[model samples]
Target chain A: MKTRYSFGGDEHVYVEIDEEMSLEAFFIALSLRNAVAEAEIPGVTEICPANASFEVRFDPDVIAPEEIMARIRELEHKAEVSDKRLETRIIEIPVYFQDPWTHETLMRFRERHQDPTGSDLDYAARINGYDSVEAFLEAFHSQPWFVSMVGFVAGLPFLYQLVEREKQIQVPKYLRPRTDTPKLSVGIGGCFGCIYSVRGAGGYQLFGITPMPIYDPTQTVSYLKDFMVFFRPGDIVKWKPVDRAEYERIEAAVAAGTYTPRIAPVTFDLDAFNADIAGTNANLMEALNGI
Target chain B: MAFKVVKPGLSTTVQDLGRPGYFHLGIPEGGAMDRFALRVANMLVGNDEGAAGLEAVFMGPELTFDADTLVAVTGAEMPIFVDGEPREGWSAFVVKAGQTLRFGFLKAGARIYIAFGGGIATPLALGSRSTYPIGALGGIDGRAIAAGDVVPVGEATTMTERSLDRSLLVPVSAPVSLRVLTGLYWHRLTPACQARFFADEWVVAPEADRMGYRFRGGSPMEFVDREQPFGAGSDPSNIVDGCYSYGSIQVPGGQEPIVLHRDAVSGGGYFTLGAVISADMDLIGQLQPNTKVRFTEVTMEEALAARAARRDRLAKLRAALA
Candidate 1:
């Protein structure tokens, strides 16, 4: 596939090796470079992901819209060739599942979606291809996807993606977010799981608690590293239930500094974020000129 | 020499030019909220522009000099008295050992800048003497100035007395006008809304701070409904929560515009409607709550010209001082 993109009067042309190319990633890289190059341009800024995605900023005057689109199309092609398969790794994270009401609410939700013959646990196990619900629950304690949490001081948010029974479960938005969500809350909202790092008002559904400290200003490195986000675009994830003892072990490992966080494979292009912006800018310009 | 703080006022903190280039790690560029006043005070004290000073918020402080020290006060128009004798603003003064410096209520403006002949010597964090109140990173223990805390002053030698430019003293009673440039999401507003933005005036909101100055009274502008974009790990709904470079104006809900200042976050998720011109940031800093502000959009070229003009002015001032 071939795609042409432009932004800020800059032209970018690129080819895609496969339809699987992730536009977000491609643009990110392009934007980062452009933002850096145009630092001197008023209103132009760029953000670079030392580890995840690339970003760029530009002054509209420094580059033409068509030029940005061309760069996007060109970068998309480069991303496709270097594309890596989406992979998921499970590392056990110990969480206390605070506030019994939160668990009750999640259990009720599971029952609402489960088949009549199976318990909520059975349904969850079946979705991940477990022969027995108990076994699946046991394994869950040893492995959990590390969600990406981002926010301000003591304010962290995690993103999660799960797949089951060849059907994608869409997480809904919170009908009414609480004025203050508790810290370490396992929340499900809008097709993702989020762990609240601090006490703040939020709407995501609470599932459980993880004793892990997601944010600590005193620490040298934060809990959320560049590469360890739970979901990155196309990666598939599943939740496994773990018992209290197993959870404790993982917690100890985290505290002892014995656990090494595994990095999730890159499934999306890091360059497409800029390309998409570039492409959109070009299209807007073209439509304006009736070309 | 050291000065003991008798009263720390509303929100006083040690500040400098701010720490820069560490946004990726989620650190803020915390410095004097009012750079204009800070710079002028520093210049008067024969300190570098980036020298650490005191940022007195709202009401001013009551301090006593433990030893003889040279000092200058700038920024807001707060009455200053040495041992109960009123003094003029902008001119350098020497206080005898054990002399008390008392400040009266703020007559105008929100912040006051006070600089010593020798800058305050505080521990540097992330390469700045500015205080990041949220992270508790810089300043004296990452907290605001407290009563009884003695601040150390650097070594200094007395210089011959010279007259200061009287015209440079900004009037406290008058309103300040700020220059602005349209930002990334400026085009997202409707044509009529865009036109109204420049035509209308805004008032400084009560919720203003070092992080940003929130404006009130402008009609809300609407943009196309879109999912909130992600920023550097802060609030997904507010882009300014992440990292905001100097002069970025982030408008949340297409309503109130928050002008990011020296203590602003490194990145953010809010829709940036426009940025105040760099040269005009000082003018904006002088504006206090209830101050009427009108935003006039300028082109990128105009912004550059303004910046060049500021640089030239600074050069001239430095030459005159030399």
Candidate 2:
């Protein structure tokens, strides 16, 4: 892949690993990101990894911008040939599909959507060649997704499907952004799936709301006790569609500080997964079920 | 010591140099919008340069100090008054107990940094008192100051009175020219649009805030035609979700360019044409609503030179105050 390096400003250097978004592009960016992190270069204040690009913010007073760029170029070359195995966690997040909250929110912003009359789920299902919402939901939950990036808000994970590019679900964002989005609303814009970490402006087509709290400044939840922000880049996520009652049960448990997110530790090898995509995904899902 | 907020101004928050190292978590390095002014106020009050101070936007807060302490107000040309008596801005003075510090309507600029002798003692949420209101972290319960709130003040180790030289202050005027280093998806814009972006003058819209400053009145930019990539939006200006650099300018729909600022969202789908250089960001913070501005393109080398000049100027400011 041809990596293009550009200046964000005097203090930031932006590195684009590829012109398009793909798992290969993300891994290349991640490899470079990990290398830069482990190198512990002085004056580097932030190392932000995105879908197919990464940006480094540094204190120019401590290190010159040219020097930082040179160091990053050298590191990128090394990262391209490095091992691509990621030891991460597969988290099962329970979602109440077509929940009333997100449904109401999406209805209010229908004018901004492509199919204003139909529900976001119905529209997405129709466009993705699924006969019904159930089939669409099945396809969504069948494969685990990689957390390609974690941003746009605190703890909000942007996910890309682990399946091959031919099977990727592609959708366009709203023509204009809506002023409001229900917090924890599971939304998809383009091919990335994201859970809205906060209630604010959004343009993604909302499908449902998650009962789990992915973000909390006050670490009230047991699982979030160690870190207020729950999601991280490279984490895998599996969706578990739940009924309203189950969603309410988890919500109450979360409020009572007794709920812990379902997480299973896994080592993901890029080469192995590339070789046998279906078998690899089945094994990953089996691991989640075993946990 | 503590100071009671007699009347909270429009959007007042405690801020410092800001908390870095959290951008990857989607938390911005939010602090005072006018960082240079904040630093000057801190220096005048004998506090650390990164000390927490009050950043009041548009209006001034009515604060009553419980104890006698030094204070300085910088940025914006607002008239500072202590118990109805006027005091000089950009200079440190004592505020006695039971006296109230207030201000008249803003004469110029947008934000004012008020530094107490000892910085605001708000509990740190992420190693800094700077408030990121969206994330609800840091600074007075992670929100802007309100009436009846009693904000704590740190102990002043060494009180001092200092005044900044006129040249040291940030200069603000109507129709400012902001230097931008155009990169990162700049190739997406047509040559005509790129030339027009620099040729046309723009005005700051009311949407300007800590998160970003939206500029209007510029000719709508046109993007080069291309087959939309998978996962990217259909709009010509839209790209796949990616990281937004601080000061990055993104024009959704190829109109109304918005420059991401201190409290910017880390990543999004909007394609950024380029970013305003760091040296010019402080000026963006000082711009008032409807302020006319122009975008002037510069090379990376020129941007770095400007940054170095700014650093030298700040060093001079510190030495003069010292």
- Against the true structure, whose DockQ is highest? 2
TM-score of chain A of 1: 0.47
* lDDT by residue (tens digit), candidate 2, A1-291: 879998787888889888788888888999999899899899998999999899999888798889999999989778898887889989999989989999999899889989999998999999999999999989887799999999987878999998998888877888889999988999888899999998898988888889998888877678887888989888999999999999999999999988878888998888999999999888888888786
Candidate 1: Cα lDDT at B137:
65
DockQ of 2: 0.78
A-chain TM-score of every model: 0.47, 0.98
User: Which candidate should be chosen as best, given TM-score against the real structure?
Assistant: 2
Candidate 1: residue B191 lDDT (0-100):
82
